[model samples]
Target: MALNYDEIVGKFDKYIFNTYTRQPIAIKKACGAVVTDVNGKEYIDCVAGIAVNNVGHCHPAVVEAIKRQSEQLIHVYNLYYTEQQALLAEGLVNLTEMDRIFFCNSGAEAVEGALKLARKATGKKVFIATEHAFHGRTRGALSVTHKEKYRKPFEPLAPAVFVPYNDAGAIREAITNDTAGVILEPVQGEAGVIIPDDGYLGEIREICDETGTLMILDEVQTGFGRTGKWFAREHSGIKPDIMTLAKAMGGGFPMGAKLAREDVAANFGRGDHASTFGGNALSCAVALSNIEVIKKEKLVAKASDLGAYLMEELKALDKDYVKEVRGKGLMVGMELSIKCEDIVAKARECGVLLNCTSDSVLRFVPPLMISKEQLDTVVGVINEI
Candidate 1:
């Protein structure tokens, strides 16, 4: 039995919670920078599952890893250690240069874990976050997230101070005796791909060290070759005290992790934090394979080269409405004087998928494997629009 678009939409309306502002077309399947709708029309996928499919959708390695792992073992509670989990932990620590790791299911769970670890390590209750930052939507993560609309309804959240981004002085002033940690995204993804000044992150690191506060870098959207490097922090050459990883971590499989220095990680005892489904055989296998594929394919270098190409092409486009074009690697954004909702719909109609963030910024986070020809077509379509 095949369901049409209306049928799927009707079912969602009747059965699903009304939260997401969904696009009209229902994607049937996706592969390597392209998605086919139920009606069989294909669109160049620029969104990349909101930057989740870094290795491209259903990459052979990831699919095979999932199949092989399922045959051996699908899932077991974290009570029993699994070889896959241990291997994945080692791989993550080596890649991230963090001393310890904690597994979880999604970006929000990772942020929640990082926040808890920060508080526990420093014995502090207050956190300082940057303005226009988006960590996650969970209660603890939401408290540090900077969007008022998301934070207003749930008042009396955990104590946190919001400071202007790219300003180390504001962070210094915000730190109090009860401050636990400071959390920030290396590149502000949801806020129009906002890239801070060259020395901003280093300044924050210095201030955090001076104040004895933990520095938590949220790499949920910017990790795993999305930003042309294994991790965005490499751009600054600073090691965060705590880091959150997800989004592309499992190559579309649900997985997240919180990593910290060894001493900071000691704050969490045996029973302090555990996820029932996290680090199970299947997720760990998928994540391990995802990392292997990223390394073997050399997608990091590909991202750096192609991202430069994409941004240059976009910059060449007529700038009558374009306010700015900026980003690092594959994480580029085009801010327009006009709102981007109508432009997004028009692009979708013209056989491309685009995401509008911060009301006016058109975010482009395509798969690292997207071809130059496909990206050229995407730019052509936007230019024609």
Candidate 2:
């Protein structure tokens, strides 16, 4: 029998690191857009594992792929090439429109790999990042991250200059002789789902081209079908020199990768970077299945259609506290004048899961496959609350 919520919490308090400020209820199982708590209460999962379960929880194809690959082989290290790894590499390269791939374990590792590649490729040390941008939590990724609370604990980080988001002039001015590249999230996820202006990314691309600096797009949270397109960068039609991906890559399975253009990727020789379990057979198989699920279900287009409907519905919310409702697709955010934590808790009580980020922004990153009725219910619950 499964342990009850109290039992789980007791074990977690004793064994787990106190890193995350977790939600109260303990999840038992999930299918598609819904998750059931240990008390057998079903909640519409708007969090979607913080945008990792894009294809939805326990997607049949992904589950099958994991099972099949685990039976055949799991990890064989990076010394030898595997068919699953090769296939996934080809798929990701084609999807990302990049020339090369470096598999890693998570978003932070992908950022680390991208940062190192940028420095090695350009023979420079500085990286230009934007304010309110969140890449990851590792040392190198943390340096580019803007929040003082996350950065203050670890000082003397790698060389990176911060610029304001959506301001191309600041980026242009920040580029220096020693600047290796500019790392940015096409749609800033952790910063209240901030979307850039139409011309913002294109202008930055031009500035990077003019200065001979690499453009590194961190699509960790915005990749897959989360932002209407396969990538948020697609909205701007700008190709980044190097790109980092992770969140929804494996469809809830942990995996990440760094992609780079042909010329830029050539700088990383055989021994320069490697990960023991980066592209293990199990992860690659699951990722391949996840990509196939996204394509087969036409989830990209669905996200576009549903995102429009969701935005319209959110904009019609009765609450005067709603300051703004903005997003590209499923990755929508409702900015409220008041802190949204209480609302999040209330939503959970109403059988809907929600996430509050940046204090006042309620982020809504539901599954790409969520039904319109389900979305309406989610919005209605919030409205009632």
Candidate 3:
């Protein structure tokens, strides 16, 4: 009376949509940075659910919070307020000077809300995003995503202009009077952890200031201490007009938020925009627990230290297959000399779970709580590959 991999895959193929070419591994149980398949083979989860498990899987504090909240008040809609949501909002405001917050269900919804805020506040319809960007799949967020594969089917997408990423001149040139907002990931996560030039964010801030455009930072994959600092742009000492956050915010629970300056946030009044399950009590409890654990455990500082160690270890593996390793905090990327898919597959055999970004770059976004020994294991796997 047990489940097998074949049975699981057959059920999924019948019921699930044919979108992602998923691996054949069926994860049965997970804890910390490791997941065990149904056959009891363990693999280090270097992907960390694509950076959504910043604190690690089934963190005790997060689990306790979810249990307590479900027993107390599980699904209080955003229409009615709750203490957990208020506390989370206050913590966020204290964390950043941003004024208002809109809680949503995922990264895509957060991007959607941010764009709506920009358009509503500026009274403009056009958005400027960077090429090779991957925001989300929703209609509003998808419109601004610059990848053709993600946008071609949904053509005539919301009058969005695609600019080259990391080019300040091109971004400045693209800023017309009609531009409603400019959105870009501080370090492009899906675009291969692409770090812009040192002064690029400040340049963007200046441009947004001069052109009267709302600056939006898509921190979906980079926020919640992945980038050493709380947010990657903080490294540049630049403030965005609106910043969208998700991924690690909920510690695996589906949650996202758009943070904006108070006056700018005020543009949307009663029912200007709404979501049915947007700030539900359960998500708030989970998100709060995630943040609490991050702070209590000082995982941010750990990310800074271990990330440095990981980088140093990776660079030691500089071989013909290895191209370059660059990262800030736990968010690292390895630009391979060749396509990295097989290398990743080989690493999976070596008891590690890493992912490839684009076709050539290998992305390393492990949990912020990854131990030095675990990182050493990662290095050994790379050496095997």
Candidate 4:
């Protein structure tokens, strides 16, 4: 029996929460850089599950790891020791300079954990975040997020101060006695793939060191080879005190983690924090394979190479609507003079999938495995639009 697209959509309308104004496509299968709709129409995927499919959709290694782990153990909770969880932590710590890691289930949970750890470590109440920044939708993460529209409805959130991004002087001025930490995205994603100045991250690190303030980097969108490097902070040569990671970490499986230095992470007591489903065997196994695939397939360097090519091709195009093209690695964004929603719809009609953020910036975070030929098709479609 074939799947009923309209009936499935109707069921979603009646049963699911109306949180997302989703595109009218029922994706039923995906592999590498393409997705097939319920009706069997295939489209070249550029969103990569909003930057969560760094290893590409349904990577063989990741799928095998998940399947093998599921046959052995799926969930044992955090109370008991699990080999997969321990190995994942070791892998994360080895990849990053951080000494300890706390696993969770999503990017939002990681951000929330990082916030709590910062407050506990510094014994402070306030946090400074950048304007146009997006951490997560959870209350603690939402508190530091800078958008008025997302934070307005959930007013009276945790006390946080907001400042302009890419401005080191503002961050220095914002830090005070009550400031626990400063959190920022190495390259702002939701606000249109905004990359900061060369020395911005290093400057923030110096200021945090001078003021005894914890520095947190939200790498939810930029981690796991998305920004060419394993993490975007490597581009700036600065290691933050706390780093939040998710999105691509699980290789399409849901997972998140908050990493911190030894002394900083030690602030959390035995009863300080816990998650019922966090660090489960299934997610850990998949994440381990995800990292392994990235290393084995050399996807990081591939992303760097292909991202440059894509950006160059887009910039070289003589288009009136293109205002700017900027980003690092596979996380590129094309700013347009006109609204991009219609362009995205048109691209979908042309057998290409695209996403627009901040109304006018067309975000292109395709699978690292996307070929230059496939990218040419995407660029050709955009040029036509």
Candidate 4 local lDDT, 333-369, one digit each (tens): 9999999999999999999999999999999999998
Q: Give RMSD to native, each candidate.
A: 0.7, 0.8, 1.0, 0.7
Q: Whole-model Cα lDDT per candidate? A: 0.94, 0.95, 0.90, 0.95
**RMSD of candidate 4 to the true fold?**
0.7
Error of 2 at 142 (Å): 0.4
Q: Higher TM-score: candidate 3 or 4?
A: 4
**Candidate 3 residue spans exceeding 4 A from truth:** none
Model 3 scores what on Cα lDDT?
Answer: 0.90
Question: Residue 129 in candidate 3 has what lDDT?
Answer: 93
Clashing residue pairs, backbone N/CA/C < 3 A, model 2: none
Total clashing pairs for each candidate: 0, 0, 0, 0
What lDDT tens digits, residue by residue, belong to model 3 across residues 1-385? 8779999999899999999978769999889999899999999989999998999999999999989999999886776879988998998877866888988888999999999999999999999999889899999899988788888888877899888999978888988879999999999999898888899999989989988999999999999999898888789998899999989998999999999998889999998988888888899889999999999989889889988999899898868777789998999999997998888888888889999989999899999998899999889988866
lDDT, residue 165, model 1:
88
The residue-by-residue lDDT of candidate 2 on 1-385, one tens digit each, is 8899999999999999999999999998999999999999999999999999999999999999999999999999998989999999999999988899999999999999999999999999999999999988999999999999999989989988999999999999998899999999998889999988999999999999999999999999999989999998899999999999998999999999999999999999989999989999999999999999999999999999999999999998857899999998899999999999999999999999999999999999999999999999999999999
C-alpha lDDT (0 to 100) for residue 76 of candidate 4: 91
